[model samples]
Target: MRRRFVIEAVMVATYGHLLVPSRPIDYVVPYSTILELYDMRDGSDPVMDNADDDAHVRGKISELIAFFEDPLNRKKIEKAMQMPWRESSPLLLSDEIQFTVVHAVDNASYGEFFDPIETELLLTGSKLNVPLLSDQFEFQDRLIEAEVPVQVYDIEDFEFAVEEGISTVDAGLRGE
Candidate 1:
């Protein structure tokens, strides 16, 4: 679960170069809790499934996915923030990336309404070890006079924000 959060963070950063914010950025995050009698089998339809199938099981999964998939939901997620992300020139320094993290908070929860699951993903310096590329680098005094700039940072350096969430229940207790 932690790994997924980290991956999502990096993905959001790297893809920011390709993403444009569509709304006023807010930072209040919404956490969800689903209460189900039991769990469901993967790929099994609860509507026509067996006795083990739970009625509210699929609803929870669908709701969870929808919250993170819809653009509207993403807007809502950003609404929980302190500052809004606007169009800026390509990032060139570690400080710029760090600025984003200061306002990034964990406001996600996944569990049953009563007995739900909860996880937290906090960002620290260790989480963002790499720096954003300031400028293309070249070997100035090489034997050959070839002049080419090389990409020096991971694509994740550019990710500015995220509008995603995740949820999971306990193990061995699936409804379907």
Candidate 2:
């Protein structure tokens, strides 16, 4: 069986430009580097300004991607994979963040939860019933204080909702 790894990372828009065809832009950035950029952006004296050019943004994104994808980093990730799941911290940076590495197939059925604004990425599935962290409630309160929206849902219920939506769409397409 082919194995796929999901490395949950903080989302960052390093570069964005309007395309003639209106295609959605996608950026692949390392989790830690993006967090650093996010902090800078949120800082009182931001590193980036509205006048920043696309070339600079693109260059930074490329540099960070290359840095993270280097052989040394790959070796680190592989080494982490070999450690006990509970003890291992998969992503090299961001001790503040937590992650659980599971098979990609398991993720498909159980679903993953990500709170971009709070930088909380979770790996969950129906195969495992992991308890929420004690501090998760405090984290949500912090998000509320920061005026960030928070929504909580059961994984199994979410999966059922998604499957129902997909089936409904399929039925509509088939004129049922």
Candidate 3:
């Protein structure tokens, strides 16, 4: 029998989508099986000359919460969450999983985020080695130096075409 290993941790980067498109429902929904950690930093500081970046972050979070709370969207979210584990290998087993949220604005901070966690699987494994962000290479090097039994997977690479949908209400407000 195949060993069933529960997802021990889900390390999510800021602004990264945890949901994917569901063609049948024509909506995006959250993953049902695994818990997600939004690795967010306290955005107390102003991001630009006058922009309140923290408020923007909070607004985004509120929008997501509203999406999840809608009765019309619940079924789709549930279906999406269950589909992967039922059709394929189980990503998470029945256990208490560790969910860590690390906040970093730059590479040095991102490297510091990994110092404490014992990461076994790093999603988008191929991208981990690629220096997409200033600190990515250094972060990868740290993972290597620490010998943290890490496995990488490029699961999201397959869902590259899905466009982020904007709500009709928002569109109307924008006079689109």
Using TM-score, give the best candidate's number: 3
* Model 1, residue 169: C-alpha shift (Å): 34
Estimate, for each residue in 18-44, the C-alpha lDDT of model 2 and write its tens digit: 111122211112233334544444445
| Pairs in steric clash, model 3 | 6-92, 6-93, 7-92, 32-81
Candidate 1 residues 1-176, lDDT tens each?
Answer: 11111222222322434224332222211122111112322455443344433434354445444434457544544453334322112221222221122222233321211111211111211133211222112211210132111112223332332232111222111121
TM-score of each: 0.20, 0.28, 0.30
Candidate 1's TM-score = 0.20
Ranking by TM-score: 3, 2, 1
What order do candidates take by lDDT, descending? 2, 3, 1
Alpha-carbon runs more than 4 Å astray in model 1: 1-52, 81-176
**How good is model 2 by TM-score?**
0.28
How much is 60 displaced in model 2, in angstroms? 2.4
Using lDDT as the yardstick, the better of models 2 and 3 is 2
Query: Best-fitting candidate, measured by lDDT?
Result: 2
